[model samples]
Target: MTDRDLTALLERATEDVVERDFAENAWAAALAARRHRRRTLLTGVGAVAVAALAVTAVQLGGADHPKPTPATSSTTSTTGGTLSDGTAYAVMPQEGTEGQLRDFDAGLPSTIDVRARAEAFSAARPPGSVVAVYLRADGDDLLHPVLVAGDGRHVLMGDVDLVRTTDASGNEATPLGPRAVGGGGRYVVFPQRDHVLRLDAQTGDTVSYPVPAQHVEWAGWNAAGTRIVARASEGAWSIDPSTSRAEAVPVVGGYEGTFRVTATDALPSDVRVTRFDEDGRPLMSTPVRGPTWSLWGETVNTETLAATGAFFDQNVTSKVIRRGYGPIYQGLLVVEPSSGAAKVLLAPENPDGQTGRVKGCCTVLGWADADTVLFQSLGSHGRWVLAWKTTTGEVFEVARITTSAPDDPVTPIALNVGRRS
Candidate 1:
């Protein structure tokens, strides 16, 4: 088909869809950058047919017909419910089961009484309860940030206009990062022109931290969960949530317990992980070889690190080469950055599966405890937040996200899992 013809077809096909544009190239670049940022860790962690069209693009671009299968899941007696931060989820008994997963956006109101709902949540809910926030679809070019709790509670945070100067990069969509839900799940931060807006879910209060530039991107909390990390026009900064004090930091990485973790490419054969003390002094360096991408933190202990990566052969005899650096042979990689030891914790039956689109097996949400790491996986089964036990190799479905249609605006922009470890 001609370029104009394809454009017309796409427009006609998406007339009833939301007004947001889903450019594959743009999204791929964004996804790649996001994946790169995943390796640089502060220790954290689509709608659209754009859905059909993107898949079609992949099929047209490659001839590698790799059959994909779901990763093995352990059904052992796993119980599901609310987490410590009031995030709710279900336990999947089998591969195809939805368990207690329901449409999180079902019956969502177009408008919400932010103050009253916040007051109600504060009064009725016990301590340690915070509502998760999501950027819901609104009209053609606007997004509404809604607060969600595990008990099916919903609160509208505010509306963000895409056509305006809300984002410094001029991108209409929300910036993807760990800061969407941070502060131990007690807060959600987003950008508003020159300041970083912080929503205190526990108290139904909002605080603004002004920056020097128009668009300030937040990186969530520091290793200690006391300060917020961010980057703006000036440089990298660490902000104290209590006093709203912003301090510039030379380098930012992940912290677990007492150690600060960072990684770099030493040579083509391996990536070097360095451990630093609280005073920013390097103590040790370990080389890990073969992981295409590695993420640190989200571990039961500081010695172990969790990551997602893919592998490929140097030579391909097929007619069509993989067109882009899309998702390939990927899985959950368990790495001991301190010892330079690495292994696959879980990998899809087909590493080059369709859902592996720029991400891998899943995105590590946080460490649920010393033994279990929680992550959101997209595969043949569906989109799910699962708990994987590193010691036992058992997988428990924590929650399954349900969307009404391919173009449903209720699509989740960010996911928050309470860090219990």
Candidate 2:
């Protein structure tokens, strides 16, 4: 086919695919058939025409038309086992289980803790229960009291207060002095200037440190607890607990968004920084594209750039390249650290009150492993479904969990999955 014809055909096919709302599978099948026909036409054309036509085809298709490696089988399984309540669990790839889902009758007071750092943390039980939970605590007061997991079985607790107390004796407890706190085992108290103490939840050890007189904010830890990110008067800074090394990186632009050190070392590449004015209006927006350093392997992938807003905003931009299929819109694209290949997972469309319309959105809810990605989709009637995909393209439907009440929207609490041990 001539280059013009090929371009026209691809565009028409894409438009049709979108209008019909073809799922990823159907889309792939249709593309493959069209590709075969294009190849056949190219073969039948004369040699003199082939040279010019081939170049045109290549240019029109862009460099993203290389055959994508088929998705490999994933060992990761996302099964929602029965909870203690005898209700079948709806499992997502997540770190810990929800206690509320397991036993609604039980009134377990959800525990919260303020970690020294603000990082992505996961909570899960040993096994034999469907009460795993994971949560990202950004510093927003409205969402501050958010419950990561309320399932009644295994509860992953967070957002607790660091308090000060005294003994039976009238002697006043110094701010830096160790004190016992209820619900906390062996509390280590540290001073944060003005009679304020910093306590470590994981370890009871406490220390005295200087914090600004004004309200102090806690960011989370990096992959390693060695580095803790915190916000103070000067802005955000990374503090190395071991070496006491502290350095200020550029302040993250968001007001109250969660910060997570991805399990992999992929540093934020292709950052689309948007600065806002005092009135929450857009002032400036710029895109920074570069190689992102991976945290796990420490390798860098310059093949594609990832995007995030520089300052805080509700929406962010992202890019993903799908082989053979070309670029798929509104899908989450993640590059495998091990193979350095990109995998594009389609997100469901917004449900516009149409049954069987296949309206749902997908997010890289969490990582099942370095190679496997766990995704969640909300089907019609607010039903929740979980699926797993590997870098190689294999996709499997794990289970259908539950639906959110129209009154109560169930935001993803936490997601983590792995091969059953």
Q: Going through the candidates in order, what is the number of backbone clashes in each? A: 2, 47
Candidate 1: tens digits of C-alpha lDDT, residues 84-113: 222122222233332322211211121222
Any runs in candidate 1 off by more than 4 Å, and if so which? Answer: 1-128, 159-173, 179-184, 191-194, 213-215, 232-234, 244-270, 274-285, 293-304, 307-328, 349-361, 406-421
Best by TM-score: 1
lDDT (Cα, 0-100) at 143 in candidate 1: 50
TM-score result, candidate 1:
0.55
Clash pairs, model 1 backbone: 48-51, 310-329
Q: Candidate 1: lDDT over CA atoms?
A: 0.36
lDDT of 2: 0.24
Residue-level error in angstroms, candidate 2, position 103: 24
Mark the regions of model 2 whose C-alpha exceeds 4 Å error after superposition. Answer: 1-152, 156-218, 231-235, 241-329, 336-341, 350-360, 383-387, 398-407, 415-421
